[model samples]
Target: MSEHPIPDAPQRRTPGDEFVQALARGLEVITSFDAEHATMTLSDVSKRTGLSRATCRRLLLTLVELGYVRTDGKAFTLTPQVLKLGTAYLAGLGLPQVAHPHLEKLSAALGESTSCAVLDGTDIVYVARCSTRRLMTVGITVGTRFPAHATSMGRVLLAAERDLALPETLPALTAHTVTDPDVLRAELVQVREQGYAVVTQELELGLRSIAVPVRTSDGKIPAAINVSLPMNSPLDPLDRLDQVQATARAIAEDLDHLH
Candidate 1:
């Protein structure tokens, strides 16, 4: 599956909206950069952020002055200082630490890549990952974000509780991508009822993944774990999927204890 940056938060009626609009725009500018787009020109940032070139340039220069980004006159790349934003988040979240070992063990047992991800707005961010080998062009790593509707982990997280606020149109990553919102909602409903999700060739051809929710002791689902492979399989491949479920349960137990 392809990776995407976290989308902007939806606008809402606020008591002091004007005071935070600039801050929100600045955050949007920073989030626009991702693994695929490390360096971007003013025009590139403008197009990606849908902001005017003047506004984008102002924001970029401000960030550069703040040492969050560096520029070679025409192109801009994030500096090491940018990591603080993500690191601050990971440092606060103990999910990665609790789940990392279990993910590694699961990957070793299954001989496949395993990851634990949580829903962050419209995307699922991989907080913990144990990769065996490259299954897709996009390598598995911590902080990788995938479209929620097209991934097993995403579906599991979406189906955990509450209705997902889907986009107006789902972007088609592959021929089998389910662009229909209704169909995806149906899939999410099934995933919620089934307690797991298996996605085949939806995000990429030949890539299949099975995911189960990682629940806390109080029955709160904060994340999902997945075992991904290259070959396609039947709809209900529960035998091989047992390992993933067991890993998830153990990780959930550890998370509960941590809390």
Candidate 2:
């Protein structure tokens, strides 16, 4: 679950009283804590968030008083209370309510695992998943994140972006991962043309997945869904592409009807 911070999206508003810099800085402090840096010292937080020690300390103290952060007199870690924020956001979107049934149906149909994720900067964060069994070393949960360049869902989501961004260097999760920028771009082109993406043992050994974008009625791809299985599985992922894509469309249609 090691991941980079979710990069801030470009905002139209300029800095002003309307835009609360302190609130933004407070959120930055919260986001600085991730799986890789679950617990950090004052200096670590300041360095990670690019906030001064004085500001970091003040914010940390405030978060502590608010029960969103806990410190053992040295290292600070986020409290479970912080999860309420993410939970509130998911509830607001009603995505789990809309997508979970479809994921379960797809998983049952394919006798495999199904998941839905949204692009968050350089990673894809799983927001809903239905697992048949453990297929990888790390557990796949609602909050699990994987590198965008080496995942089927990530590729499908990235394909939908008009301006795809990639780091100067891509991390090779496994021997089969496509790290070369030129080659990865070629594969993205194929994914765009074919309307799906198949990643073979790129994220981990013996793991393969196929993903398709979940497009709303207005043709906006807000998320991507995928079916994951071991490399030794008897079923061909391509053969099940139609089923998975149909499930994705169903989920999208149901989501659109909500509005």
Candidate 3:
């Protein structure tokens, strides 16, 4: 008998090999500084990303050279120039011009807050929001981010993200947040099966919301629409859920037509 050799499997692409991947990591380093960690030493960045201090310093220097970051004697912080990167992405999306008015209409009709969100890693970012009043406490605004496992918009977006790799155990963000990965996976499954997601007081106390996918004519979900209400609001959850789902579907249909 002749000897045979086994076939080799294809090698996977590493983060370092992809074009623009390094730029993304650098941008992440810039974004890692926020109000709480507005100014951080090189050691702080190393601790946050678990990268070596040398690596963090190199990236930080690159970012500073690009005008996306500024540094003092011992600490570094993001500069306003960093907004341009995010602004360029938002400009390319072209969603705000089309969806902002619809969000406003939804909020006006329902007397609640409405928003459009897209997935960002393990979080959902509000790209557009319409506030009905000034009484809410979540302090949500455009560019705000919230954990996907704890919000209706996050679950709806996750459900639409069939390619996303979900873990077996989820990290908790709050007391009511779902920590069991299985439960979150089940919730995502339910969202897909039901075509919408309803979350109550998971991200914060008295915060309730419902979300539905915003799909294109080709049935590709690029974002999600959601209505946020207070837990103690007199409005019934089922009623709000129906309204939000219907409005979101209508918006999706309108977008499909435009596309």
Candidate 4:
């Protein structure tokens, strides 16, 4: 979870005849829990998921019975069993299996943390990572997520997915974060032209990162890779962009072979 509040779940584009609203609402209830809201009361969940108290209770109780959530009579928290859902998703993609070795090599070469992530809604979700040390206040690992507008990898993904609308006024994660949509859009255009992005002290005060997009052989931009370092590090992120780009290309090549 982040310091920012979770946004409401997105509505379906065209929930047609076979659409199951109950299942969708149930998933929303489960996703409402994050690191910041790890332990939420029934009212808290209802508010976060935008579900009625009755609906929230029923879904929470169902999750609890299914071993996905646990309750202490008053508050609720996700259980380890919930990891199964994320695990199934990752296993289906086989992304970690394909990228972990390359990320490890890249991290070893750069002596920095390297990660692979995909855009989901307005955020980036880490699918694979190789960390050299703890850099941010929160631990960066598989399944970690960050707002798209304020991160290097997020910018790369957003630049690649041009049709996804950028919010008019993005949240300022730090003093250096780009909040104006037009300014951010221009930066993304530059990123698109240059084929990479570098973010400095945006997501956090002491963090800087550089990222490149990873594309498949058929020309699909599926994910992005990044290397994170201290904001005041001696090495310039641009000086090492070539290496990061090479790693991204290698990962993409491997993924192409997989397909």
How high a TM-score does candidate 4 get?
Answer: 0.91
| Model 1 C-alpha lDDT per residue in residues 1-259, reported as the tens digit of each score | 4575443333434647457767777887888888788899998888888788999889999999999989999999988898888888887778999999999898887777888999988779899998888878887678888888889999999887585678789988789888898999999999999889988888788898899999888999989998888774343446667788888899988877877
**Which regions in candidate 4 have their CA more than 4 angstroms from the true location?**
1-4, 8-16
* Candidate 3 ranges beyond 4 A from true positions: 1-25, 132-138, 162-164
Q: Which stretches in model 2 have alpha-carbon errors above 4 Å?
A: 1-21, 40-55
lDDT of 3 by residue, 25-88 (tens): 5755765665557799998877765556887898999888988888885999888887787888
- Give the range where candidate 3 is weakest over 10 consecutive residues by summed lDDT: 1-10
Per-residue lDDT for 1-259 in model 2, tens only?
2343444332334788689888988988998887768899999898887778899999999999999999998999999999898899788877777899999999999899999999988789899999999988777788788889899999998888879877777888889989998898889899999999999998988999999999999989989999999989999999999999899999999989988
Comparing 1 and 2 by TM-score, which wins?
1
CA shift of 140, model 2, Å: 2.8
Worst 10 residues of 4 by lDDT: 1-10
Give lDDT for model 2: 0.88
1 versus 2: better lDDT goes to: 2
Instruction: Quote the RMSD, in angstroms, for model 2.
Output: 3.7
Query: What's the lDDT for residue 258 in model 2?
Result: 88
What lDDT tens digits, residue by residue, belong to model 4 across residues 82-104? 89988998998878889999999
Candidate ranking under TM-score, highest first, comes to 4, 1, 2, 3
Clashes within 3 Å, all models in order = 0, 0, 0, 1
